[model samples]
Target: MKNIKSLLLLLIITSFGFSSCQKDIVFVEGSGPGGTKPTTYTTKMSAKVDGVLVECEFAYAQQYTNPDGTKDIQIYGIKSAQSFILDFQNFKGVGTYNAADLISSGTYVSGVNDPFNNGHYAESGTIKVTTYNSKVIIGTFEFKAVNTIGEIKTITEGQFVISLEPIPGPTPGNTTTNITAKVDGVATDFTGQAAYVKSTLIGNVMTIVGTNGVKAITIAIYNYKGSGTYEIDIDAQGSYNEDQSQTGSYATENGVKTGKLIITSATSNTIKGTFEFTAPNMVSSLSTKKTITEGKFDMSYTTTTM
Candidate 1:
């Protein structure tokens, strides 16, 4: 969960990149509009110091297309700055990180810390890359901090490697179903126009469909209830679809999302549900279920903690 994309930072193969030497980076906070937009791209890197893991992330999900038409992602990071937050404050920087700044020219290990950020520090382990399907993953890097109080820390080494799949287009139905509703007892109209995507036989159980970003995405009503706890995560896939960050509605830190939804009411063309949010940064590894009978069947996802 914790946007474990940082673990899949398999850079280029040995033939496409420099020799197996230490890599240094010059991390610029932002390129243009300075906000949550990730300045890092196309590389993966991780660190483990002391005993904790200081995972670094790179925003390369928007880049690279494999011949099979999937996204082969890569992430990169900085050695001097393993984390973007400290001191009980979340300090998200403007970009990816630099490695050589903290490690020697050829060595794999590094000294990583942000002296001006939160007063927390650590000694980090080596960063490596692993290959999966059409993508190469990087990370499992650890950063063991000396101070745990008021600090952004990594307790263990974790890895999340997922291939960027293609989002199938909308399915065509003879009936044009419309849904209107208020969220969490609020009387506000839906934000963006919904998209009608044809559901792919993508997963094993849940016949997944639709996008849930700023765009008003039209998903085949999977589970509908008047009032209760619920959750959903909708996203575009691969280079074939537009980037979530570009629309500025990417859920939580990973751009995708995880949340609880509580429905208050529902009808023919109108429905209502209470929406709750969870940080998409880490995985969700728990079986939390809500039952709503007034609506249709149901759907769910597997996740860990953020």
Candidate 2:
């Protein structure tokens, strides 16, 4: 269940990152030379859970291709601490999928605990795909899920519009990539012609760097998994370099005790998250410290093989 939650968080973050910059590609369902665009068509998700309204502020879908050529589509809707997830395995085009078939399932997470244990898992449900293509998917669903305690949550009036266009990674010299944060309560923006952002994945470790042509921020994760909160220790590290000449400040064993990296989403080509750390100056003569807070990054990446 922990792994399930982590994977869901990862998918949500990745969907948010892709939706932020590539919202321009609009797909008019059934539109042609004489067809009128429908006003209700938009990328969103809304439903009723246990007779209460749940209009998700964040929604997205992901498709995975299996080794045997079968496909799976997972839809997610998140609102604060609540989330609704629907999964359809061995997906075939536009059709109706029933939970009784064992190829489809739905989950409703109402709190921080595992949905299957504390929340709910679909006991009966049906998902109907209305429109589907290489770039877009339209669907509706309803289900009744029961938790380990026998409490049931009924979900209905669910609908969603998911985009499937690929999101491209930042180019090596692209200065428009963004990474922002606060240094001691001062806003610091890294973008435009003054900044450069990049990431590299080698084996199970991933390193991310952002520079403003002068100062720089670097974060390294030793055992890179999908999405979750990571502590700054020997496994995870962060550093802030003020200039090219100094040894900089680091969130290492010799530094202060507070530091964390929260990865909201991560994939083979993209990553998004928040971070903060407190570090003492590496130079022994200087007793100064550097504190970074409210740090955030959303950018594509490249990978290097072993």
Candidate 3:
């Protein structure tokens, strides 16, 4: 009994001494599925705003490699109709980065009604690159952004892992074949060896450019990532430009009268589709309306991956 009491007293003293010499520290990690450690290069992120769960998506043009070997890595997070852009510039490898300035800092908004009205700028933030390699890129970030309406949001515990690859280009035979269409009841065929097809993804939008002989056509689809029927609008649709002039005669036009694009196949590096639209020449005083039909395009083009 006496030995037990002494042992208890010694344990009490030791516990007190240990507690006195102990220090407490806290570590906050990124939140989400596989946030702490990512196994693959798939752009994904999650954060918290005002103690509420906020989920965000990484944009298509999330990463870009400059000619000088510097890399511009950007990640976008959207939650509750609000969006933010975290821009990390001149980042080549694993290291710490500061928000630097307006250009490099994060930007945010309540909603993006127009493509031109992107969002507001981030006043401050910090990003730590945890992983970077040919296999994958991972990072954690936190920032504060204010909208144009003077609303501020604190983005916290942000982390992302995205697949990395060099920018892609159209296949060798992308422009070798002939692309046929009808314009204003006139049969048109874009042919020749110099003819080329180019497709680019900006954010969620996709723009396909095709040029043959003296005619060039540009088609844009909003939120285009897969096969679907996309409606055409006036301010942002299809156009045909006459390149005969030295200055190039321009046509600011929109799709009218049952204008639609039907995408049949979409892959990582290829897209095939058909389209029909009525385009009006906005540059001319007459506003000449051109009916485009029987349009078909099959091209293998590359994209800039995140």
Candidate 4:
């Protein structure tokens, strides 16, 4: 019994000695998602406010999928944001805003800041970010509006380069194609498709250039009135130049129209919805809302193990 007791005491002391001799440990790792991360992503975002062209950048170390199955972006509910300064031909500084001034302010909408009663901005409109990039070729860091005396103007549907970061690479999707524009019952000419689109994980922005005469259309998705589900809107160049003319023009097919796209359909690699060329106008003049009836777009996505 004494030997057993002694041995027990010895074991306890030995354990205490060993525990006291232990040292801290750590391990180094690779940057970002580590080496096992996927090279591509299936991305989507939403923005409110119709009849305007907004330019913003996105940066994210990760990506997300909304409950409604829509893709995710860095931020949403963009009231007024810009990415370039040179494009500010008509861009007036919304009153006097400092950087990061109105961030997270509130849900901004058209004519919200209009003191002029012109149904447009009463002063220089505010964008979340007002900066420039390598591919901006032209334009200022101002909000764009259709037929407004404000500094903001509309962008024809051609693709413009925004800033983004390059990953190792992505499984190249069709990056190039021609799409038809339908406003009401008129079929417009094919302008071009988004090409050379690179994703910037930092800013969470997707930058693309137009090809074969493709116009850049802003596909915005946002959660409004609820979560998961979103409201989608597309801003193109203009409407069918002569709505009644049998022949359509690129200007007509690729400009921003007063319309919204309700994402009624979605898939792993594609999103389908209604395209109404005239929305605000339909809401006012025709006492009607226009829907593309059979308009759809196929986009590519990359999913990874988060």
- For model 4, residues 1-306, the per-residue Cα lDDT tens digits are 001122112222222221221112222323665544432222212232344444322211112233344422121211122211211222232222321222211112232222222232213343333322221111112333332443443322212222222222111234433344554565533322221111222111111111122222233231122112322232322222222111222221223444444545555434444444343221122233333323444443332110
Query: Per-residue lDDT of 67-103 in model 1, one digit per residue for the tens?
Result: 3443323333333323322111121212133212232
Write candidate 2's Cα lDDT for 82-179 as tens digits.
77787888889898888535688888878543434546888888888998887777888889988888888999888877666543323324556568
Top of the candidates by TM-score: 2
State the weakest 10-residue window (summed lDDT) of model 4. Answer: 202-211
In model 1, the number of clashes is 54
Give the residue spans of candidate 1 off by over 4 A.
1-123, 132-139, 145-149, 152-156, 167-306
TM-scores for every candidate against the unseen true structure: 0.25, 0.52, 0.44, 0.25
Ranking by TM-score: 2, 3, 4, 1
Candidate 4: where are CA atoms >4 Å away? 1-178, 189-216, 224-260, 279-294, 302-306
Local distance difference test, each candidate: 0.29, 0.65, 0.53, 0.27
Tell me which residue pairs clash in candidate 2: none
